[model samples]
Target: MSNSPTPSLVKNGKEDFHHVEGLTSPNSHINVGDDYANNVNAKIRNPLLGISKPDLLAQVTAFCKEHDLEDKTSVFRKGSLLAQHPESFEDIEELDEEDKITIREEKTHKWRLPWALYYTVAICSLGSAIQGWDNTGANGANLSFPKEFGIENNTWLVGFVNAAPGISGLMSTWVADPMNNWVGRRGVIFITGLFVIFPVLGQAFTHNWWSLLICRLLMGFGMGIKTTTIPIMTSEIVPAAIRGGLVMSFQLFVAFGILVGFCSNLVFYRIGPLAWRFQLAAAFAPAVPIVILIWFCPESPRWLLKKHRYKDSFRSFCRLRNSEVIAARDLYYAHCQFVEEEEAFKGTTLAQRAKEIFTIPRIRRANLGGAIVMVAQQFSGINIMSFYSSTIFKEAGSNTLETLLASFGFGLVNFIFAFPAIWTIDTFGRRNLLLFTFPNMAWCLVAAGCCFLIPAENSARLPLIAFFVYLFTALYSPGIGPVPNVYASECFPLSHREIGVAFSIFINNTLSSILGLTFPSILSGMGPTGAFGFYAGLNMVAFVIIFFFLPETKQRTLEELDYIFGVPTRRHAAYQTRTWLPWFIKRYILFQSNARLEPLYHLEGLSGGTTVEVMAIH
Candidate 1:
């Protein structure tokens, strides 16, 4: 075959219309059908292509004919057109439509985030704060409530009381995806606020441990839904450039809630026997505004797009974005993404969907990564230390007053360190931060555990334990604290995002429940060293899993990740461990001088649609 092949002769001894030979185009025009062609026409234009559609199509035909890929042209999917004939279009342009839009949008968009976007996300994210407050508030309350309710020495009652929210969170997490799918993300979040408010109020007035447990359980149910939806909702609203930082604001507020809960406990501790009641009730304050403010915010544009409400999605996108161009560009790509998803899952039923989630190699890998992230976050022992910080301090030889102050310090460290993630999540990339921090956390846990083995009579005992505990929070807050929430939310394809996130949350809650329920028993049986040692071991295991499994999700749009993880083809389950990614890591991430770096990540040949975009993050 020549470098540029000629069209084949027809049955009538005349030339065909210059298409690839094997393709059977019955008419002069290609009948790509309504869904595929319409989406490509409206949503797939890119100045970066530097060629007209007719020219590009002709070139693709020639390239296919030369390469004997003529049969591939008859099957048109969203990205398959480009993926099938990449060598033909290599010199056209470096960027895709999404990158061009990002470049054009750089100056056109606002310097400050739009107030509408800010307030909406800020208010919705308060649910995480409510989660933070509800989960951590119990810790302070448990210190005194156990004694007041005559369960201070009863380890089982204490564990049950502490674990209530997690148990309920697990149940609610199971229902969250279907609920969000049914009522929408906003509706689930709205309903969650009610759960947070009333349940916390119930705890405030409860007279017995069982009653308090009931209140905590209800609060957990609310948090379960809220936590699952917040990241999804936030990510859908923001532009890809800042989505990481903004979604991370959800965890930042969570840290703030932890701080508030601890401070509330500290102030209330000075009040006498009824102090714990005030601490539990204080969580209700943040919940009230979240309920009202969410009413003002539009439903997620992605969710609207998923429902095929195109006009509504466009309007919602306009509201979420800083400019008309950004909104328009993002909306088109979102539509293209949705259309591809629809085609991919066309005839599949619910049973098939579930089966595919487990059986499809890429989806399985993505879910496995998601589950690992959530489980790592839980088993890293952040909550173990968080829920029992006061107890841990007491075990380290602090008096009651010192323990309370030390616990407050833990919350402060958590709150303070979380601020840096807003920058690091986007700048350092997701996988790098996790790789760097998980080992630090493991070291801290191990070191802190060793502090407990020191004789109580030693002068350095209390300070060393305090230093390691505080360092643990400092290390954890920046990486494991926020990344898992954003990472899990971004890892799955749009079709499975809600259920994927919810499933991860379910894993989170299940692990959290086990950890929360077992802490008191673990403390009783293993002492502080054995408990911390166990967690340290888990963190090390998590580090290995993340290093080998989780791919970097920074800077890529949710749609772009589908190609990177091989969602459309299911070919590359071990994406991060593969060739291209390691080359990327060594050259770009490690800044290795000898490493070869590609200027653009040419995704044209990877996806199943011509509408797919190339991502150049550097």
Candidate 2:
């Protein structure tokens, strides 16, 4: 047989529309079932292809055809199409009617963030809370798992159980993004939520440590995806003014999750050995409600619109947007502006995207800074203290009664102090609290380390209470608690925010695992002083890194950060406040305390100082 190419139907030497298959998912830019699809579809085309890059597009269309896919159009000028057939840029479509309407919406009145945005954010936050609960709950329960599982003397096994999920989370970063870019956030949440329930249930049912370990790893992957993607979903749904608070809530939810985990584990732990499964199985509790809520949850309209799922995007907006027409109109417009901007940025792959982040000098600084700060959060010894607090109390000469009381107090303080961050975060801004908290965290570790330096038998009760109560929460609430997730998301591009944060969370859990694993070993080698002091040094290094790199992004837009940091002196725009610590020392304490004496940092302030004196400082 001759290996000949099929004849090109040379009678007329022409291609025919006869080869065209029946209708597909409608290649036009319109969202078929959405409120805004037809209009939006008319105005924009596929982001990956040009308005009319014919040569490149034919390739994409052919590939789509061969794959039995629709001949979707590239985002382009109304009534226009791509001119090319590049394998990557084919199947491009023009904006349909709904997309065009969302794009064209230019509202006269500014809209406050809708109340439903709060619910959406709150629910996203709730999912994040589960991740935190999973993360920090283990720390609280570490006291029980070792003896219960026959790993009582095997400290390394204990470490592995605690830290291994974090390792799994690191490798699980890429599942949400780009994938969700096509699938939409709601679908991913539904899928991811369902995925976690099975693993958590498996972990609950398993008797062997190895089986439990595998389940925990799978849970981490599921949780890591949620941690990364939730913030972006929350951010997208929120308006600019409250956005910081809303997105910051996701970070705050981590604390809330830990609080829940702590409380739940404590309750379940006290119920006896049978309760261990209940405590372990408590993992599935959050996912059940989340799955149901996600049923009512909207796909990220921005994502829906981006993927040419305009009807879904519009319906999403309709479901989440307030009943008021003005409010609905305003949200619709922002979506349009965002889509228009997205259309201008053509064909972004992983390398192209990463390169864009790096090419902008300040963005590079911000990205690296945020990444480092997130790493620093894990290294601040919170993990050591969290997983080992009960053990620490036990070792610090506390009997069962004292240890239980201390544990109760620890839970109370963490839950209570978590809110103050919400207030000060917006009022004082991110940089002030974060920078000030670093030195405090450093010294807090030093003080805790010093407790171990003294002979254990000689320790006093008051100082011991101080170590666990005021100092620990102070170190956590502002420094490591909120800053890690807040700063990480604030640094990246809107398009890449979820994926970037996913990796940051991956780093978060990775370090969390390392600390969880190493604490027992470090505890053995260095005792308390050597291990925590090592962490103190790490915090000091972190402060230096943040000082040089992290900028105040408290209330600014992502676009503005680039413009501000592009100039040398302009970088300090939002970080201009003088903190209370530096202010207290320089303006009041050094002079009043005499001879510039070392001012002790007691949380208690002097009441004797007159209102007039306080007024003068302000």
Candidate 3:
């Protein structure tokens, strides 16, 4: 019960050094394993910490000159000191009231950001909308496109046409890395915008199954690249405190796009033989805003820094952040971390980095974590709803108009429920949300599937099925919906970010392609009850894997995560199984007030200078 720091202990013939516990009290001791200790000491310290003011000033001056930032020397000097000793900012008498006030406001008014930042996020979010719109557009068109193309009875071909985007996405996602390295995030997005537009419009004019498949395949190429880049762009620019909620805006807009697509389906439902054309063509509307407005936003600073364009990176940071001081602080800190990351993979080719994603322990762990979440998103069965809700409703015995209406209701519920994740994804934490929602989703799927067995004469049968399906969407919108992209985007080091994200998306789209290709058969062969029940079982499988493998990653900086993921998988899984599960049972299930839980990761610099203990309880 003492509040004093514990003496350093020796383990594995090495002295275990102490870090100031930032999560609880400053005086508590964090007893970490050898892996955590080695990873933390090697990668997680601030280089500027403990340097004399004169030496720090000299380094800042050299950085400014080297980066062509001489005009901001004063700001850099202050920012470097602030970054070095964030805990004692008030003690640093050199900072003016304005600077202190700005730092204070960061916590108080996290959402009150600059117009350029908002505009940039808005454009990126609009790009995300294109994805959702594409999905539901295909959903509505599914009812007519197969018949129009004379493939309505060919179940396999129908599935392939619907899955064209995902199949092409699998091929194109790997290209995201080189493209990102070559043209920067904005360029990749802009080019992908063209793919989103023309090919999507081409969907409206295709006369046969092969032509329609070709157009959708082209659209998938753009989707693969855009999906890979936009999340990375948003994750790189946003502040870490609000990163989850903001990056999750990607899913929110995807939900919004789904809603709009459903509305378009209903609006054009009466167009005689051509209703599917307008539904498919309307997906291009969201893409137009992305192409026109992307240039107006600043490029991602992290991307700039990756290319050694430090001056431009600083400017981009300024536009993204509220003040030059905060911008410089972030830029310099990121630069320090980037230097460490670069040293780890210096002179390596893209292939080498890709290899490291599997070979290096730290990078491999991140890769696993990101991949699990991405796979989980697919297995959650949300996309089945997005891609075939109208078909699903029709299968449930509704007329054509009633089917569209029910699909719209699902879209509306999906979009409306996504709003809660904006607040929850950060505060509730990523891993906790997944653990809480997966079981509920599993049961919802089961219940919806069970409703199909009810007598057709029973009036409540259809309504009950819709209710359970809507409930599943409600749970998914906040948990798995937003977490995957946000979690995957931030887990990898900046050096491996593009490739890492690309690999994760590759898994996502590949599985999506498989699901799309096979689901029609799954429905017809197994029927709705068996298909839903099969996916419901997957929900539990996903939940178990997540519980054992995924570590909580909320509120940690991108750099700080190097240590969190560095913890060996066996070690983290053991902690969760042995320590966390017992505590959860005692505290929540048994209502024990005296239950004490152990923390998994101890991280610093979450807010200014404070260290936080990342507990499994979230």
Per-residue lDDT of model 3, residues 286-396, tens digit only: 888788889999999999998899989999999998899999999987886676466445577888778778876777889999999999999999989999888887888
Local distance difference test, each candidate: 0.71, 0.57, 0.84
TM-score of each: 0.80, 0.70, 0.92
Q: Per-residue lDDT tens digits of candidate 1, residues 432-550?
A: 78888889988898999998989999989988988998898898888988888888888776777877787888899899888888899999899999999999999999987777656
Give candidate 2 regions above 4 Å deviation.
1-113, 308-345, 351-363, 399-404, 453-459, 462-469, 558-618
Candidate 3 wrongly placed segments (more than 4 Å): 1-47, 604-614
Off by over 4 Å in 1: 1-111, 346-354, 567-602, 605-618
When summed lDDT is taken over every stretch of 10 residues in candidate 3, the lowest stretch is: 1-10
How many clashes (backbone atoms < 3 Å, residues ≥3 apart in a chain or on different chains) does model 3 have? Answer: 5
Clashes of 2: 52
Better of 1 and 2 by TM-score: 1
Top candidate on TM-score is 3
Tell me, by lDDT, which candidate is best. 3
Q: lDDT per residue, candidate 2, 145-228, as tens digits?
A: 667678879888988987766778777766666657656677677677875788877766777778878988888777777777
